[model samples]
Target: MNYKTFLINLDRSPQRLADAKKQLDALDMSFERVSAADGSQLTPEERACFDKNTAQKRYHYDLTWGEVGCYLSHLKCWQKIVDEKLDYAIILEDDLHLQDDFNKVPELLEQLKTPWSFIKLGNPFKPRKETPVETLARFNLVRYDKAPSGTCAQVVSYQGAKALLAARSLFFRPVDVDLQWQWEVPIKILGLTPYVAGHNLSFDSDIQQIDQRKNKAKRSGVRLREQLRFFYHSKLRGE
Candidate 1:
């Protein structure tokens, strides 16, 4: 394949990176490891991009610093794809377990008849609706009604990379959640059935922050409002 592959890895998480590397080696696939942005190490200027008021308005809650950093990490991958003039690139988070047929990616991608902004290779959660587009040798390409919840593995087109980068400049939620807002992004996102990869079952997530606010005492009215907004986004908006 002419496309490049990038694996996001934080410097502090060398063990995770090493584990991912071994899997890639087993698949005989080469990739460049991009240093992930650590939320705790953001500078003042970078931190300013995460506007609290906007985040609260969009998500009905403030986005965690780790979420901001995770969003930035994916944005960086998009920027690199654009700046390097690559046609498209497969992006992988450093905690995926590759399926045996993962090596057939290059060949299978050639079967795509339509242009796609993003093609999710791993689906941690199945979408409510999926229309089969093409039946490849080992997997079927499907157009999904909603974005899946993981950024763990996906192939991103150059145009999709640019669009996502521009749209997410002032992101208001976690990277995966933000992706679910397709109305805001305006791009074609596809999925591969019987996913090529999935999250490593043995590994715990490092990027997602646990919410501590659930234990706090809050007014019923405020709590009710948050639930309504969530329902609007997740159900009404189909995010």
Candidate 2:
């Protein structure tokens, strides 16, 4: 259970950071705050990882700047895990509500005898097909047949961090979506359910706002392509 925890928060969003701090403090879980990358202010070096043409070709649509920034923010956390040689690390976004049982995560992980790379601690918005892997005292560890959206909170092992960092050159999809591409990382993403954390919904999401603006300007062909990809992945590929 010796692990580091990082909370990603935009510098302009001090209120969100304060809110998150309150929750973590109550749990007596100390964490480092990782300054989130602001898409609007990305440096040339940070922007180098993103290519509009590549994004359009891979995701069937142009990624919003916010989405790209979000991915970069996560990359910083993964790099930290590798640099510090952490056994595992909990990465958390600023807007979240941690359940009381969240503190028992270490105990839950200790029950696992086999190796695990990534485990999501947050709840999925919709129900997902998953097979039970272990029955812990307060939560069940399950292997997601199809990983869900959202990067609100997750525990990533050193191996998971390395795998994710190795695939950074191919960054196109959103971080959450990329995590679902198990073939890319070749990691089995697991989940803890019933979830120990969830989105705090009170704060408006900057990424959601950016997504809305981008969606309004999407081309008809891009929309169609997105629909096709969804169908292929969900129905055909059974992912």
Candidate 3:
């Protein structure tokens, strides 16, 4: 399949940048690496969105917001991709690995575009049972077909891109959590099937932690509560 590859890179991580380039090169995948915060190139609208601050009092929550900020800072990157005009694209973070024969995934991409609007090739959870994937408005979550780690990678087609674009206005919160929910809940609510690679196409773990603390999120509760919204109360309140 003919597709364009896009990677989100942060200026702070030189080592990660080098590793990412090496991995993609090894896979023989052509891609474009764009900084998540190169404002000179961003649209006026993109800049304002990233500049908005919710005003948190606690530190951990502030950190969460920062992560969200970092993620949000990349909106223009996605916008640019859409503007450039492509049916679908492979989006990756600064740190991700690929299979030895990853170059042959174009065929899988073609297959993925059929049933689901979007597909995630890399998942943290491994694929076990063959659960049929449902097609959401623009993406699909299906049983593992590729690897074991079910949350390692993701694939999105034009429809998925449209979905993401539609939800773009709704992503004012944390990037990872927003992505997690968008992949799981909204996709499901919209009746899109979500799938995991079941394979290890991407990787992120404790070792990569920018803070190196387990309860960072818990510690963050006090300050970021407002940002989390009312629904989050159920988890915090344990109702």
Candidate 4:
């Protein structure tokens, strides 16, 4: 399969980059390292893409700077895919540990005869409901009734990147959560399982830590409101 592979890593996290390099090198996979967008350092133009009012109405809370940066970081990869006109690309966050079967990903994707835009390389959050779409030697490509969480790893096609870019110039939700709104992007989301990648729990997540600190004082009702909004979108709206 002809595709590019990109690993997102913050310049501040050289150790994580090194670790990722070691793992990918051992697997004989080639990838480019994308410097992640640091929330604290977003330029005026980058920060303008974040819509505060929309975030409050849709997510029931303001997105932490970390979340904004995370979203922008993923956007960089998407933009690259569109600009370069690549067939597809495997995008990986620094915190993931790829499985041995990761090499089989190309074969798995090659078997799909139907149209596909995005395919997650790992599982979603708890309570996943998957319908098998196709089976390969080491992975089963499935569609989720419930949209998956986390941008840990995914295979994004040129069309997928174009669709996402056309969806919005301004975003209100986290990148992963935004992906769940297929009604908006109008793209079918798929996944592979058993997962070809898993989180590397050893490395602390700066985004999570920053969010915890920022939302520590958040009201209990905020959590309930967020849940209700998610249900409405995913269940009632069929997003």
The 0-to-1 C-alpha lDDT of every candidate, in the order given, reads 0.79, 0.83, 0.49, 0.83
Structural RMSD, model 3: 7.6
lDDT of 2: 0.83
- Score every model by TM-score: 0.87, 0.89, 0.59, 0.90
**TM-score ranking, best first:** 4, 2, 1, 3
Query: Residue by residue across 1-239, what tens digits does model 4's lDDT show?
Result: 56889999988889899989998998899999999998878899988889977765666567777888998988899899988889899999998888987877877788887678899997535647888888776567888877678888999999999988888688987888788778777678898889888788899986875555366344457568867766786777553
Tens digits of lDDT, candidate 1, 11-66: 88899899999999998999999998887788887777787776554455566666
Q: Please give the RMSD to the true structure for each candidate, in Å.
A: 3.3, 2.4, 7.6, 2.3
Q: State which candidate has the highest TM-score.
A: 4
Which scores higher on lDDT, 1 or 4?
A: 4
Instruction: Please report how far candidate 2 places residue 57 from its true position, in Å.
Output: 1.7
Please identify which of the two predictions, 3 or 4, would achieve the higher lDDT against the true structure. Answer: 4
**Candidate 2 structure quality by residue, lDDT tens digits, 1-239:** 56888999999999999999999999998999999999888888887787667666666556677888999999999999999999899999999999988888877777887679999998647667888888876678888767878999999999989988987854877888878777666677899888888999899986765555456345567658865766576566455
| Model 1 misplacement above 4 A | 209-239
Q: How close is candidate 1 to the true structure, as a TM-score?
A: 0.87
